[model samples]
Target chain A: MEKIKELDLPSDHISEFGDLVKQMHDVDVNMCYQCRKCTSGCPVAEYMDYSPTQIIHAVRLGLKDMVLSSNTYWLCLACGTCTTRCPQETGLLEVMDALATIAESKGIRSNAPEIAKFYETGLSNMRFFGKLYDLGIAGMYKLKTGKLTQDMGMGIKMMRKGKLELLPTFQNQGEMRRIFKKVQEVEKKARGATDK
Target chain B: MKYAYYNSCSLRSTGREYDKSLRAIFKKLDIELVEPKNWICCGSTLAHNVSRLLSLVLPLQNLAEIQKEGLDAVVVPCTACYSRFKTAQYEIAENPEMAAQVEEVIESRFEKKVKVIHPLEVLSSEPVISRLPELVEKDLSGLKVVSYYGCLLLRPPKIMEFDICEYPQTMDKILSAVGIPTLDWSHKTECCGGSLSITRPEIVRKLSRDLLEDAKAVGAEAISVPCTFCHLNLDVRQEEIEREHNVSYRLPILYFTELMALAMGVSEKDLLLKMHFVDTDSVLQKVVAR
Candidate 1:
């Protein structure tokens, strides 16, 4: 998906963010009661600029700018730990995902650019190959991030063990391209509705 | 028992050993595994992060194909792929709007009832578990390992519906039945820095180190896992984690299927134990003839 310009701030940014999350993910942020259960169970809570509970609270209070600006969602592992623990069944993973897609839609640069690049590289690989080319994705990620020598040793060892594929595999590439196009169309229509 | 096998991408590459051992064990169990024609990737974490619709559509499309082929169930060995399939079904069942949107994207109706069985669930099933003890041709009770469920198999309890999320017993149950003893330990459902193993190796090192330390403290000789990313982070990255942290954890990460294959008298060479980054010889040597 191509990056687009950020939309102008709406009168009620809180409702805008909450409504979009509710509409898109079918999750209501209003259900979170500030119990901090999500924050407590999160594996990467220590690394997040704003913890999962705080992000949920921010969403409730309509602190979209603050929530989107933080590195919290980008660092989220999406392991579903908090989602499982929440008594409210708030679907924390979907909330984090909404924040991520929203950040990308607004063209707000992620604080964790490498993580963002990793997702972008992976999605592009899937769109083109119909299957994930692990070797290709790793090679491209290393080249793009300039971490060429970071895991060079491990890469060689894996290659020798026949664990890493030397070539890309394909399956129904034509249908995959069409599916990707349809997804883009759906997302674009959703974006237009939210912007209005 | 017949079912379609969904190897996903990892089994074809980094986790090929898992594929080898699983096929080996299933052959011994007398279960038929059929690979559906032209099965595509499940889109894994990458799809959901980009567009929620794509994630559901990808796996839903695969399910549609399996259903069309007259198969009602599929065996998904990779936990990551299994989670995606489960999540897709959960989303569709929970939200009709999503179901319609997914139907529109894939140009097909998803058979939400199609069974997505992980190897852990398959092995622990009544038919298989009951026959495990007699199937053993080699003794493996000497090898002690902790069962690491990682995140996908048991998390988001509502969606997965496999085992208890926090204190899962499925892996341990399967291991014990085959005369393989598993140590009780924490970090069963903990996240292993998953896909971040690539983008954020630092975090993976820290998280994986904690898990390895916990297993060592519990006296586990090795770690067994069901997910590809978990195996890659815990097994392949063991050396890097050791060097970066100034410690050595020679714990070999093993697939539970490999252990079963060993018990069933599948040769060590056939199990692909040598392909692991950590030396699995120490654990392999512990197996005695029954």
Candidate 2:
């Protein structure tokens, strides 16, 4: 376990962020007691702007800006290590998801734009192909991030090995579109209810 | 003995070897695996990270297909896809509100509870386990590897509910039954920075290097994995890691299914060993067919 940097506190705290997290994930953000168990178990804790424990603390304190803008949630691999090890069973992984979802919805960009772009590019691949297109996602991601040559060698090697598919392989694009549309409608309804 | 097979997007592409080896071994063991029609992607971490409803519904779309196929269980070889199916099952069963929402979105009645299982679970259990020793046409006693479960298969224990989350031994037990031995090592269930491999290669490099270093420290010849991303991160990125760290750890990351296939007498061509970036010759050379 590495030492976590001090959490920079903000004076004005908003309660809606805490409520949003609790309502979205059904997790009690207040259950975290600074145990640091989540932090110790986290593989990317050292790379985080605010460690898992501090993120939960910020959520509980309603430090919406700090928690949402921090790179902690974006860097999370969704490995479920913290969720499994938490004594309080605070559902830290879900909390991280909720935070990222909220951040994306609010159009608040985090420090890690590549991570966000990865998710966006992957979702677009799913939308068009009804599944992940390996070559497409890699090419699109590189174009979006403008790091076109990052894995150029590796991509060619994989293609040579027949590991990279040249064409989209999955079916049922209509079903995927309907699923996305219905999900949007249902989420909008849920948000409307919550906003009330 | 029969199960529906859900080969994820990765399996059709980067993880073709895992798909080939798993199907080959299951057929040899006399266990039936069927592929349901109109199966779509499970939306993965992207769906879950953005919309909870989308995550649950995406997997349910596939489960609904399984239900229509009249199969009681589906064997998902990819641990990430397995986790999504399991999470959908847990969430739907536990919460009526979410279930109703999912049903509404999918526009179908998902009354039957289809069991979502991983290949590791099936292979580790009887009658597969019982028939394993008799089916061994190759001697794998010379090969020693560490069973890497990665993170998704076992963690967040309540949803997965398959094996010991922290120190899982299912893969180890299956290997032992096939005449191969697995060395006890830490970081069995540690994450390999899954999707971050695309966005944050440095993290994948560091974490995967840590896993390789640990496997080397424990005196294991290779590492056996049940997850596609772990295979991609560790095996495909081995050269990059070696170059970046300026160290040599040419560990061949094999799918546990590939090991089972090899031990069960499946040929190298059938298993598609050429797809791997890391040369698996060292591991394959040790297996002598009876």
Candidate 3:
């Protein structure tokens, strides 16, 4: 396994982000032995700058900036290959998620603009519509991320081919709104409990 | 028997044939499938992997809806949806506190409780398979198939305890009922790299190609699977894999329901062979050609 540089995290940093780090630790972050097995099994490691092992390491060190800004944080597909295969059985995926929560809480956006935009747009669309309206979400994502110009020809061709539907079929809009509202309340309570 | 049908995203969009065939086969089997009044994507592997809570919430909400209808179980045609629902159920059932939290969340939202079942489970049940012999209009004598269960159907067995995780023969047994022979290939429970097809095509291509080649090596004329995602990966990605690996591999992938429908004498057009990225006509035509 490649040796990872140990960062000398500031004393105040640990105190400031203690709760978030504690939540991450609750996922058994300390069990990692730098084996890199998680990285080896990760499907998205090739696409990420930081391997799964490195991301976990970053979380343990309380490097919020590194944890949030790294492409590994956003690029992770959460396949559970690492978590399932981890020698120590540490929930490496959950740790990454806790890191993501902290990142999102701090309003730290993904360095990969497209993925961040997709995440925001996809979640907001789901929250509002109670289900994914793929075409609507795609259009919104394209418009927000400014990639609409690059894929204009392809989008048009897909529309012409009848691959892209202009209208979405929603199942139950009122019920979905109720569900989203409940989830929001639950998450808010969970966050508040953690803060206390 | 009546079931709450949880049609995952693929069935609604890309794999509509699965939805159609499933409904048709159930009707033929004298089974009533009720689509949940309000359904959402089961979050599949993506949501589960990204956020365990989000993944659990989606399926738990669906299950709650099924419970509201007073149904004990749901028949999920999509393998990913089955896996997600089963996983959530297992987790919730194991942890009472978490289950309470989930129930509170779901009850507050939908005011219901729900159980889930995969179509394979329903199809393999004694009640359904006992009628198989009577329903076979065309025996699949010429069709040689390899039943690909994929990881979702069998893996994390606590969640998917419906069949033998290592070597499930439910699909094979159902296929044999209609006269199709199955190869005893060990790749039945192998991973197909599913949506990884989109995030990482190369890995999916390699994994899918290996499964197909193994099936072909064992003299399988076609590969049959219960998961639409597996069908998409195995069938659609074969072209790319063949080009990438420079191999002349052409394997027609069919949903287990489609095979069942074929044996039950459904027409080719109704099964939607034209919609498939890989042409099933060649392999299927041989079986029904006479």
Best by TM-score: 2
Order of candidate numbers by lDDT, starting with the best: 2, 1, 3
TM-score of predicted structure 1: 0.95
Report how far off residue B169 is in candidate 1 (Å).
Answer: 0.4
Please identify model 2 stretches exceeding 4 Å from their true place: A1-14
TM-score of chain A of 2: 0.91
Candidates by DockQ, descending order: 2, 1, 3
User: Relative to the true structure, how large is the alpha-carbon lDDT of every model?
Assistant: 0.87, 0.88, 0.71
**Best candidate (score: DockQ):** 2
lDDT of 3 by residue, B206-242 (tens): 7788798899899988898888778878876677788
Please report the interface RMSD of model 3 to 1 decimal.
3.8
TM-score of chain A of each: 0.88, 0.91, 0.81
A123 in model 1: Cα distance from truth in Å?
A: 0.9
Model 3 chain B: lowest-lDDT 10 consecutive positions:
B44-53
Model 2 superposed RMSD (Cα): 2.8
Error of 3 at A77 (Å): 4.2
Question: How many clashes does each candidate structure show, in the order listed?
Answer: 1, 0, 2
Task: List the candidate 3 regions with Cα displacement exceeding 4 Å.
Answer: A6-26, A31-78, A83-89, A104-113, A138-166, B45-53, B94-104, B108-113, B162-167, B184-187, B196-219, B241-247
Return the lDDT, model 1, position B21.
Answer: 96
* Interface RMSD per candidate (angstroms): 1.1, 0.7, 3.8
